[model samples]
Target: MAYTTDFEKLKKQLNFKPDPTRPVSKQASKNTKMLFEYLKSIYGKKHLAGQQYLQSEEVEDLVYYHLTGKLPAVRGYDFMGVSSCKKTDDQVDRAIKWATQCGGIVTMCWHWYAPNDMDDYSKGSSFYYKTTSYDHKTCFDLCKGVTEGTAEYEFIIREIDMVSAELKRMAQLDIPVLWRPLHEANGNWFWWGNHDEQHREAYKKLWYMIFDRMENYHKLTNLIWVWNGQDKCMEVSPDTFDICGDDIYSVKEYDHSSQKQRFEYMTELAHGKMITLSECGYIPDPDEMKKDNAMWLWWLPWWREFVYKREGYKPVFDKDGYTVINKKYMTEDFMKRVMAHPDVIMREDLPWYDKDKHKLPDALSANLERIKSK
Candidate 1:
């Protein structure tokens, strides 16, 4: 129904003149806004939380502490994946219970495995690549094996399916998990990378198949899908990706004038679908990226520097330790520079996850605002 009338019109307009400088028309805006509101109503209020909200002030505290060699803050970035340093599962559960004792939502991170369903290995380090010992390979292998395998996969699916049941069991919780998946698959290193015909073909096929297979298929409408990928991958202009992108990674000091080119290229190609950073890393001298013509002149996961010691391919370690990466010295000043930018921690631009049993609306809004901003 929406497509037949409102969506169709917008699609036609974009087809006619697809330019970022040109704003989406009034009718299109109204239509899209209505949809956004309705979606916000459904997911934001009923599923996500009662209202648009924010938490974890002083975003820099998280990064600054990490920079000083201290752990991330307890408010948002603490848990390695699920639990905080101080709390056990039961203790954390008790804390969530306490938050909702007054009737408020508690947030969690929703995880989705990326670059899967491929016959070969290439998208950001797959099992085929892992046998050779890439750092991401082991994690990817576990995630894919656990998520795709019948036993563990069934458990993961059942957990999501059981969310409603959990909600029914408790009156205090209403928070929605900001689920993100297949992040940064656009790079040619993942199993589902779109760089090659075979990989691209398989990626689309997997998306279709994933939709077909999930038990809680209804929950997808509730889930917010964020696609993360390297900016350079869009150069091929190969396949049509349905999800909005989040910038996955970049180095600050390199000659990266091409970064924004990559961003604009991907954004234009997306036709205003919605794009964010997903995960922000640190980049010193972001101006270099601007000068280099790069898009999204930022960083993602300082650890990814270590993580990039990926399977099979050794882009950074091509030879002796002499093989260089971004900047040999990621100085404190560089860290401070990135820590100060609003763009780094914006959740809408860089939502770390959607499922952990809670969410922070303010973080989400900050990111969404950045994307909507001119």
Candidate 2:
């Protein structure tokens, strides 16, 4: 996710004089370019966005793009490496809408599913269950997907159905929907996280059930399914996945000689579905791959590099036949691929809630506030 290259580090790594005016394009920038192009090829733009199930009147221009953030790779656009000044969810929506106006998604997350509020309990923990009792909940379904039989999954299922209907209404407005549900289930810690010893089976079952019920009953097919999760589990069930959602956490893990052993095994199993690093935040290492411009690795947040960028940190890319994108410290050069990446988004023409970018308008803010208070 970095944009500016370190001339001094480049000099030390390549053992040459640093470029005085311009940063060296990793010297192997060509490989990075090729990898990105390949990623774009696979992401393939989706223009025929099913149906105008969502609608709104605020859209000045209509564009078709398959929104994938908050998908399997980037978690959500919130990982921009910047702590938000906006605290409330409504404010966040307003900010992301700015990005949407620029032809992108306001990809965000409703994370941390703790029920009991215990020290270690997160969203799935009993703390969360007590919270989403009457509300049409999204995170609740995610928690139910991970920990089966904690409470009434039926209630969560009903809530999902209601939300799906709402989604259908949005689609009617020609608003392309990038609906991600219970993502990163493979990454342990989340209520539905899929560690080997954790709720792996439940995770898969939940997705299958969700998909089956929604598509078969609700007929909610106007969604680009994204399966985003970290494969911390040594044994991953690719069959459990309806789509591909691969994530990377540590570049050092990629640099370690064992990275190849770890990632290569997973890639071979992923079955080559439009895959991406949903939560890229790592800096690529200055290794043979970097020499060739092979940046199929994921990116880290821009601010995470505050101390590490100057520490000779290199990214670790341990997989193959894949492209990794980083957005941290992203500059003009970084925006270049985001240039084409957004091209892969599914374009929707719906106008539902478009005035405020799919969120309730300022006028309705009070109603939502009253609902929350109740």
Candidate 3:
């Protein structure tokens, strides 16, 4: 099947125009540029299907494939391991494997635990404002943190250095990442967000600090910055970010609307940049997205429990005896329909998919046959 041919037809149908701007990183890797172009090409025509895993394992991917006979084109990861000093390398290694062995795109966000305050591995390395003693009321004094020679400054810098080293591994392997740091900052739930006017300015400064250290200082160019502050006040400089996104979790369990209102709001906030549903609970129905013209670049459903249901479903056990649920937030029948939809781009449908290089699970063939049979 010719993926490009279908893409062209969809592009013409949607009147899609490729954006001329390059990635925020002037020295972006070749893979990064290609990924960016691919994203722009599909912007108004189709959306990439994505799924997030809480850890390095492919537990969620297995469950998704079991139901839909498809794997997400984009795989999401988190940097919480670095903060917790646990299995950090495993996460990075798995991301590399997904990109090289599975022909998938990688997007990652940082759930940045407070650098100095939290004891190592406390509360399972929670980054939440309420659970930690990080004191959002006064906030970590980002001004001091950005300044040199201060304890606050050294702490954040140390944490950034640790994460940067891992990113450098991916950069060395030429893997382009959709790197989103300080996500959902519009909500007060995360320590980085919901700051007063004074702290908000400091938050922006913190963003710049990380940007400079990574892009210029560390010279890591494989990153495609995805700013997800989710509020205009927390916005970093336009050039510092390649994409803008928002996290939306619907209150109604089965709501599959295009989320047109939130999409438009993010579009306005994006300032001509590409927009995405960076994180979501329920997968948006692609048909509804087309009907409402809320074409996000991609929609990534959160980890296992968010996508799966615990009741009335037989669970598969991992090698380590961990239970993986099969019943999903969306019914199995609906999930199969969504995966089979022409507008949804799955792993094998990606333009870069090479049969020899990208090995898929053997069961996928039979699974897809079952979908066709039904």
Candidate 4:
């Protein structure tokens, strides 16, 4: 009774047609299948727009704007809810609740801090780039059991297990998450990325291991796996991810030429899998993306601090200047226009997914009982 078989049965029962024209990863879970089908059903018809809010306060502004105009088609959440590196569960919950209210799809990214204290705490490893020695070779070996039964292996497994538990909670809530982990791995920023040629296979191997542990071991099926699209790291196996994307950033406004090239590369590399802008410093104008034929499933600009700033200008906190200049990047006026575009798809445009069909009733009841006992 393989878990994949169960997913196949569910897909068949639900009459989901996996688009033969698209490249669907073999490892796509049941939830992934449904998501892919939905995306395919509407490809080219509309592009989803999204934003990442750094604080709960920001959420209110986005919510109010969406309520009056167009809501984001997808909401992005970080796994800060249960990470040992940081605590922001309350903030995470607030984001999720808003998404649920607006019928927006949810995607998650994890800034999985270096395993153990192997990270150079004093220097930095915030999201990308390791300022200090965070040995990728040693860490990958321990994580993959190449150094089986060692302290490092035990420590990492314990940590990942905790992550698994948090995922299980999301499943119980019937949250279909687009799970993107170890993103931007081809870059040298994250400890998980920039492995030497010998350890080049390490990042890929780590991804598969996480998939196996979460699906086969923890039985977490409510996820759509996304692979980071970097030229060198695009060599992932056919079955690793349901979708692929690259983070697009430009020092000056949306560099149209640069955006077109990167978007084209990711699409071709995807082999028909849906391509998206996972993270962006400046949200490409919907009109521009369409003009370039770089149709992304969704484009989520980073938090206000990143999205609102001009290319090299120092960030201004002044209320008036902030409101005026930030429009160059992505202004409320621009967003309103984008959301109103016929080619753009916002949260309200989505077709309903059967909540019960995707739910883990057993897990949900157990969680409730635990809360009651507490």
Which has the greatest TM-score?
A: 3
TM for every model, in the order presented, reads 0.42, 0.45, 0.82, 0.74
Instruction: By lDDT, rank the candidates, best first.
Output: 3, 4, 2, 1
**How do the residues 290-336 of candidate 3 rate in per-residue lDDT, one tens digit apiece?**
99999988889887577654444433554433334445467767778
**For residue 79, what is the lDDT in candidate 3?**
83
- Residue-by-residue lDDT tens digits, candidate 2, 204-302: 555555554554456553344445654544323333232344444554433312134334544554455443334433323324223333323332222
Which regions in candidate 3 have their CA more than 4 angstroms from the true location?
Answer: 1-20, 84-89, 115-125, 130-143, 311-328, 361-374
lDDT of 2 at 258: 17
Reference-based TM-score, model 1: 0.42
CA-only RMSD, every prediction: 13.8, 19.0, 9.7, 9.0
lDDT per model, in order? 0.34, 0.35, 0.75, 0.60
Local accuracy of candidate 4 as per-residue lDDT tens digits, 1-374:
32222334333433233344533333445655677688777666567777766454343232224324444667777765554445546545644564454456888887765433444333322443334454432232323432344654454465567777876776776667778887887776665676565445666556666766676678786777778847654366535566777897788764533288888788766756778889887767768877878777788877755544434433433332222225556566665667777877766556763443322223223433543575
> Higher-lDDT candidate among 2 and 4?
4
Once all C-alphas are superposed, what RMSD does model 1 give against the true structure?
A: 13.8
- Which model, 1 or 2, shows the larger TM-score? 2
The candidate that achieves the highest lDDT relative to the unseen native structure? 3
Per-residue error (Å), model 1, residue 353 = 18
